[model samples]
Target: MQHRHACERRETGGDRWTEAEREAVARDHRDAARRHRHRGGDEDRGGFRHKTFVRRLRKCFEDHGRFAGADLTRKQALRDFFEEILLRRRLSDHHSFTLLGDLRDAPAKRFPGELTRRARALTPHLLTTDAAAGRASSARPCVVLVEADPASSRVATSAVATAGGEVAAAFSSQKAAASVPGTVLAIVDVPDRGALDAVDRLVAAGLMVVATSGAGSVALAVEAMRRGAVDFVLKPYTPEALARRLAPRFAEVGQHVANASEADRAKADFGAFVGSSPAMLALYDEIARIAPSRAPVFVTGESGAGKELCAEAIHARSGRAGKPFVALNCGAIPRELMESEVFGHVRGAFTGATEDRAGAVEAAQGGTLFLDEIGEMELSLQAKLLRVLQTGEFRRVGEAHARTADIRIVCATHRDPQVEVAAGRFRQDLFYRLHVLPIRLPPLRERGADVETLANEFLKRFASEEGRAFRRFSPAAMERMRAHDWPGNVRELQNVVRRAVVLGEGEEITPEMLPAEVAAGTQRLLLERIDEAEVEPFWMTERRVIERAVAVFGGNTARAAAALEISPSTIYRKRERWAELGT
Candidate 1:
């Protein structure tokens, strides 16, 4: 039986408490109040007793206790129980649930059209989307940030998340004076000398600390680095600045294995993307070759093939690197609102129009405008976009003034623009103007062993994300991945790896942990066939299979041996003999 006498009911249905049982509940409320009056707790805090009772009940259930003769897992039982307790008329307070605030199960209040009318006086602030900002996120660094004030903490938190850096935890000065283990970095917002000790504590715990402060706190910023901080940035933080500072750290995993010459750092990395394939290397060279040009570039690729990353890399390496890279998805916004989203609207321009707003073009002034899924844009909007490209001017909705946007255009689409033009769905003139420079990205299936390389990088990244001990994939699991054709490309691989990290508890991932569809695909792997007509020697065929498996599994000798059903020492000796032969 439940410990609360008021909550206990003789009826099997929780909501069927009779008038006599309600009287018993009212009496219990009065008796509890009488006992409370003699104690040192507040009597005016209206829903205190009910809240305390609910919390205690939840705790008891979590600690392995159960209500008498009742199955808590049944949906109706829980619903009726909450309804009875929450709706009960208390003898101590008239309006029982008013004190529960927004937590009460009720419809949210709305001012409707009145709020829209009032919003005409309010203005919305806009942030510049640097070309770097328009790219899809790869992996975020796991880090903590400390701030003394609530307002500053919230500001810092938003900046970190926007930049693809996960803030693991936020702490104030009064919290536990320690840093969390396994955190890659900590950004400390030091208000004064008092907070300096916290930075030192984090450093002593073997964490990399970055100290930050406002303009007036230069002395503190300097002192923090002097004590132990690895880096420093001034306050009034922007996500772009932080991203640029940590760019190297984001690509550190690929850099460890990237076999690039000193003259070819550009070949090894482009924004957040990293790969060692010949196609990727060639793409990197092409991006580097065109960074100085202001000509409009149209990037074509299958979905999830990193078209946005290509645009971001060009912008990051170009002259407009300091300016915003504004990205707008043409397919995502409605045709009616697309005008307002791409161009600013003055207040009273429409029904819910607020004050003045800067559109993506204005935000990208002197920078780059990345238009994703441009093929999906309405034909009418395409004409308007062409005008902006022809002449650097565009007017706001409901305004006569024509503003000039000095920005470079970087457009991407998975569809063929020429096909769209031939079908009359896209304007022919606009296609010619934007397609001055064309770059094509290859699909993941054609990238060969890069699938395993990308998968391993994701493993390390998501292991940090989910706070678990996930290391590598078992040999059979790796072989399973190498055989399946990833039609969804890199993005699909990222999601699968993240899911396995979240769900799999073992140190190494096995084929059983794969998604149902992927596991089915693994059964259809194309293996070599043997024939008596004409074939290579048995030993040479075995060597070739071993070599192919080693390449696909990222050159792991042990994993290759397991996949080939051979001993690790055998493969090791074979490699040693091959190296000696220099064949």
Candidate 2:
């Protein structure tokens, strides 16, 4: 009768609690709170209440803890229950249950009906979450505990489970974490500096990490954050506190992994470039195809659009990878010294030529010579550069004999080569000479979602270098960055991130931390809204934009296609369709 009454007080019901029963329950609540407060002693900031933890453990076992046919005792069954259900740890070699495959590979009926129903209910949300961010969010996201110490791992696993998240355990290798299919958020134990490499590997694999360290290791915690841990907690943290810290990030990464489109999770890196957008992938393909040939590659793009990096990638991919790659900025050099800069000069060739110096051509022998801002080279120097490209031989200044040249030339300019040729500032012969393989880099605004990818990468690198606490950008800042027209391209974005890391405090980089120009860019759209009566079909707007582009280039669909960051074939196809529709 006493046990029944106690159970009644514990369960939720209006059974008319006696004064004695009421007092007993109140005392229990007070004791639970006190234990929760001091469970980890002086070092622990917050902790799980032992009574609550044990009660939940018992309840989970009662529901799903079945040891069919095996002669396991009750104590052994309880241990397996804690490991398999609450901790979500894999028991691949267990006699009865083996979670040895992908999360989807597990049979639906393996668990009871309620758990299966819960997973199915989470499916739609998983599909819709953070698709643009390139996260593989179709499966249920798991909190992976990456700790070498078995004790710490168990503690973290329980805490994550207590906070109502699926949990998994991985040790020193972090290979097990990778094997667990789904979106993963890691809780890495940083006992010392030796574990930083594990943090790096997990981050590079695109998992979000929260570093946990014991007290008096603030420096290591900061280093972990610098190494791309999203957040950190001190040792002996409470399940409640861990949940509170993880909630925002969980929402940001889109609740948990769910089924997503292939393109959404495509690899976003090629060579030194970090983007998976169609334009960048196409550019990468083009570069690969052109790198084998000995043709002079001409690159055009807005300034700071990674034109030099493009040149380096070309050099790296070509057969000349072992040779030196010499870069000369034609615009940065004076006209008087431009000739000597391109070709070697003999001692006493001209003023300030006291010693024999090798120019870019000599330095780039058996390799590639990158001439940046070739449009800025004077007409006189253009003739000389053309001579080298044509004859593959050139004399140094004040030299009688011509030297044989063995170098591939890769030139880049911010200005359009055709426009420069037409203006007579650049030689038509030289323009054709270097335009054998033209690559036009798309501006940042046109590369969808790459902006966010780049921002996160820059944040990680800069945070590490500057030892800042910033781990990720706030949602508002990410939106602002995406909306801003990065006129200066990648360089501008790098500078903004560096500034934020050096000056901004806190874990998240907010919009206020960004430059005034970038933050204000959100409101810079030409048309903020269209009235309901004035609204028209999207095709009409697209047609107008396309037609305007074509008209601006004087009916040259190829040039207009380049300007629009689309293919000429696409323009032709769209035009034919529009004609048939007769809009």
lDDT of 2 at 125: 17
lDDT string, candidate 1, 271-345, tens digits: 378576777778788888888899999999999899888899999989999999889888899888998888878
RMSD of 2: 20.2
Minimal lDDT window, size 10, model 1: 120-129
lDDT of 1: 0.68
lDDT of 2 by residue, 1-583 (tens): 3524554443433333344543443344445546755766332112344334334333342333322112223223334433433232121233111111112123545444343332222121121222211233234356656665545654554455444455533546333234334646877777788877878878887889888887548799889999999998887775567777777766666533321332344333244787777788788878888888999999999999999988998898899999999999999998888888888799998888899988899899999999999999989878888999999998898899999899999999999889989988999988888999999999998898889989999999999999888889989998889889999999999999999999889999999999999998788543445467888889889999999999999999999999999999998999899999886
- TM-scores for every candidate against the unseen true structure: 0.47, 0.50
Which runs of model 2 end up more than 4 angstroms from their true locations? 1-269, 525-583
lDDT for residue 435 in candidate 1, whole number 0-100: 93
